[model samples]
Target: MADAEALTPRVFIARHGETEWAKNGRHTGKTDIELTPYGIKQVHTSAKELVGAKKLLDPARLAHVFVSPRIRAQQTFHLLFEGANSVPDESVTVTEDIAEWDYGDYEGLKTAEIHALRKSRGLDAERPWSIWKDGSEGGESPEQIAERLDRLIAQIRDIQRPAMKGEKAADVVVVAHGHILRVFAKRWLNCPVDLPVDMVLPPGGIGILSYKNNNVNEPAIQIGIALPVTD
Candidate 1:
């Protein structure tokens, strides 16, 4: 069972810890910020339980660690592997591909604020605005998001392909923002970028992605995994 499991690859997606803008329901794209004190503490707690030998994100099995090019996500990744020794420094890459969705016009504004602004501009009269569907004005469109994510997906698959043959490390970790990570999950399953992605990932939350039946071509989301609850 251990060897069989080793033959399969998994991608662990972790949303960055909360920032002030995040707690206040701001769009927070391209505005780099650090995690709050409470956010840092919570991520540390989660790391203690979720990362280690035989844990969900064992450093021993990690092939790569992809982090968003944002301060909050960088902090989260640092805290996540604070005392870990097996993770090689060379294996980690900071990438813009996993950064938060570029909410150009909506940056630092809440959903309601965005709606009101759009309405004031004579937009969204017949329908409410949705970032997933309409994307942000003056920022990345759905097609742009899909293009970057597809490039990332291809890179990850190339790294994981060797694992299918038991040649190298198989597991990978992605530390990024809420919106982009959600899109990453959806895109991993080859879902259309413009469709509604009905999913919620809280601050410092963790989710898993793996291949169906251990086949690299069949990607699927792992919906359930046991982890220690932080009080």
Candidate 2:
């Protein structure tokens, strides 16, 4: 049997910096909001952390770097990797698969505002009525988000396998919105998708994941998400 240590690859992911809605705890789904001044700063700080990790991950060895095509996420990568004022080849790819959850009818609304609207209509705005569960207006619930994330995870497996890279596994860094990233960690660990209801992420925060080992039952995975405050 092979030693229990050499096959895993480190996967790093970071949430985009704060948008005006994100700072105020608003439900920012598919809003395509831009980062705030403080948000730009936060992304820079998060990027610095990666620079510090260079000993273990040389820039050339980064293999792949991707971000959600949404402005907030794409901008986060730009700021983190190249200061956001200009684009760089090193951070040019943005994929739609990891974009923020689609809020449908709830786009651009604050939780407080939504709650107020609910109260005006005599609807419960607490607990179960919250968007994560029953969903809001025409939006998808957390369970739906989990399904989307699972699809993306499958894509990751194909992209990272050694054969896909022509003999070497392709390691990557991803920049994406907050909620999606949190849910991803929960799923990667094989924990229940809704389990991340307890996870909270600040702007420019990060999560790291690694495949532990593949075996008969399932793949062993490790997820390490950082909730650092930078700003």
Candidate 3:
């Protein structure tokens, strides 16, 4: 029998580079924004070290890629594969299912601002606001986010299952926003979206997901793909 590790496939979740709103710590849902100049530099550096043959995300081995409809995410995806000879257009799917969390009335507000707005509106008076639990006012609930992400996750698993048996290309990539990608990681492991995800995906950051022991039934976060960069 072949090694279990060799047969298992991987899913790479990449957060888009920083935008002005992101750098300002504002809620930027439904606001199509471009990556900042520094943000472009961040992704260019990331692509240089991460995407290539024998690297963490070899485009040649990439089976498919799901990208957010947001401009920042689209820019990040293009930058990640800028000169890579692999990754044809047919393998990419631009989707809203992976877009940033809808902030609605709280859009463009920071966490403290959101709390103040909620308090003034007589909401969350008994407890502090938690987007994971309370969700944004006039926006999507945890249930709605889970519904869309679940559908996408199901599609990804269907594609990955065959690859786990060595029947096809194995690597997959998702380019999206920070909050949504964190929720995605939780959903990939069957965790409830209403609870705190306890994970952070910084701008231009990358994370991996895969099945444990080569068993597609057991999805897990891959923790040791690369060495941590130190300044």
- The whole-model lDDT of each prediction reads 0.86, 0.66, 0.87
Summarize candidate 2's per-residue lDDT along 65-167 as a digit string, tens digits. 7678888887877666663233337544666667887777667777777777777778784543555555666777777777877787776676666533224
Candidate 3 deviant stretches above 4 angstroms: 1-3, 226-231
* TM-score to true structure, per model: 0.93, 0.75, 0.94
Query: What is candidate 2's local distance difference test score?
Result: 0.66
Candidate RMSDs in order:
3.2, 5.5, 3.4
TM value for model 1: 0.93
Tens-digit lDDT track of model 1 for 67-125: 99889999999999877534678999999888889999889999999999999999998
C-alpha lDDT of candidate 3 relative to the true structure: 0.87
Model 2 earns a TM-score of 0.75
| Clashes per model (N, Cα, C within 3 A) | 0, 0, 0
